[model samples]
Target: MTTLPIYQLDAFTSHLFAGNPAAVVPLEQWLPDETMQLIALENNLSETAFFVPVENGDADFHIRWFTPTVEVPLCGHATLASAFTIFNQLGFAGDEIRLQSKSGILTARRDGEAIVLNFPVQPIVPGTASDAILAALSQEKPQEVFKVVSRDTDYVLVYESDKTVRDMKPDMSALGALADRGVIVTAPSDSDDCDMVSRYFLPALGINEDPVTGYMHCVVAPYWAGKTGKASLIGYQASARGGFIECTVEGERVHLKGRAVLYMKGEIYLP
Candidate 1:
């Protein structure tokens, strides 16, 4: 039997039971895709990240993310959790780590007590949200809907208030039947501490609600920056287990900063 180190981390929050939990596994070599998918299914978190060190490259590791049901092109919280596991548990000495992923090279750096992830900004366009989508998300109408086309994430719903976003009870069956991955609902924050509030639902991805999603915020921060005329903003994901995200919109990259706490650590005995 081969043993691999596994870590579970709560990303985007300083405390446990607040942020999005992700399983991080460090491997000397990659397991089969089926095995990784099975592991993600067994973990049953929002996401699971696996990484293997690269011998020669600017990137320190090759990382991949998986949901219980499928592989995702990019995942921000899991990447942050993977970096946390590398720096804190795997004894990585560097202050900066770059990962090669399907989405391209992602960089994570230590910033005081938090990890800052540099991710590609997802561009949005005016979306064609159908009446069915409007009905599935909420009884009240949305202010607007924008599409993040490249990521398979269909619509970004702009609700009028944070309360509206928080009070939504989406039809998961209806949402899953849509032609895209999922929808993100956001609104201007009610609190002064945060500029915006959001909730993510990806029923097709087997995640009905993501607690705190840094990846979704990559699409949100830039759009809000254009609307609010602010380059830096703090967002709160108001899921059952709430969490915060610090966002800065650069030219083509979005900087996502958040804290991660170690939730569980163990050795996985693989057959």
Candidate 2:
């Protein structure tokens, strides 16, 4: 029997149940892919993150994230949750935590009570897609499309209005059939509240809609900052379950900082 430590945490918010909730499973050794997938499905959360120590790095580990159906290349909330668990509960004294993920080397630091993650910036390259692509979203066509070279291979769609960004009842099945990783529907903030806002609907990657997606900012923050000529911006993930992030776009890195609260801690007894 293998006893695993599992934690459920709300990332990007100081209060419980206010942010994106993720289940973090820290493992001494990597488990079989099938078993990990099953566990993730059983947990049935937006994401379940798994961690295993790296071979030579004393302070680093290899981490991966999964939805119920497929593994994801990058996941921000889960990464935040994983680091929070390590720093606050795992008895490790450190100001920064590093994890080598599929997307690349990622780092998180404690900033006061919040966690700031310096992740690779996935710049959005302007492009266009078919009208069917527009039809699938069930919303007005994006004024433009943003592409990236990162392994996430996502397309960011810029909508004309915030109401369209939110009200579009996308055909999940059709949008999910997209050829790329998925599409991100976004719009400029209508209110004077934040710099911009977004909602993720990745029906193709087995997620009909993601509640609070910090990962999409890898593209959104940089795109918006370039337009506004500001390196830093505030973003609100306008999902039904909303969340906020304070972000800054540096040369080739994106700094996404937010606070998280632990929601659950328990042992995983594998039989």
Best by TM-score: 1
**What C-alpha RMSD separates each model from the true structure?**
1.1, 1.8
The pairs that clash in candidate 1 are none
Model 2 Cα displacement at 226 (Å)? 0.7
**Global lDDT of each candidate:** 0.92, 0.84
Which pairs of residues have clashing backbones in candidate 2? 176-204
The local lDDT score (0 to 100) that residue 56 gets in candidate 1 is 99
Runs in model 1 with CA error above 4 Å? none
TM values, all candidates: 0.97, 0.93
Summarize candidate 1's per-residue lDDT along 1-271 as a digit string, tens digits: 9888889999999998889999999999999999999999999999999999999987999999999999988899999999999998888998999999998999999999999999999888887788998898889898988899676456899988899998899999998887468899999998899999999998887888999998899999998999999999999998999998999999999999999999999988888
C-alpha lDDT (0 to 100) for residue 36 of candidate 2: 92
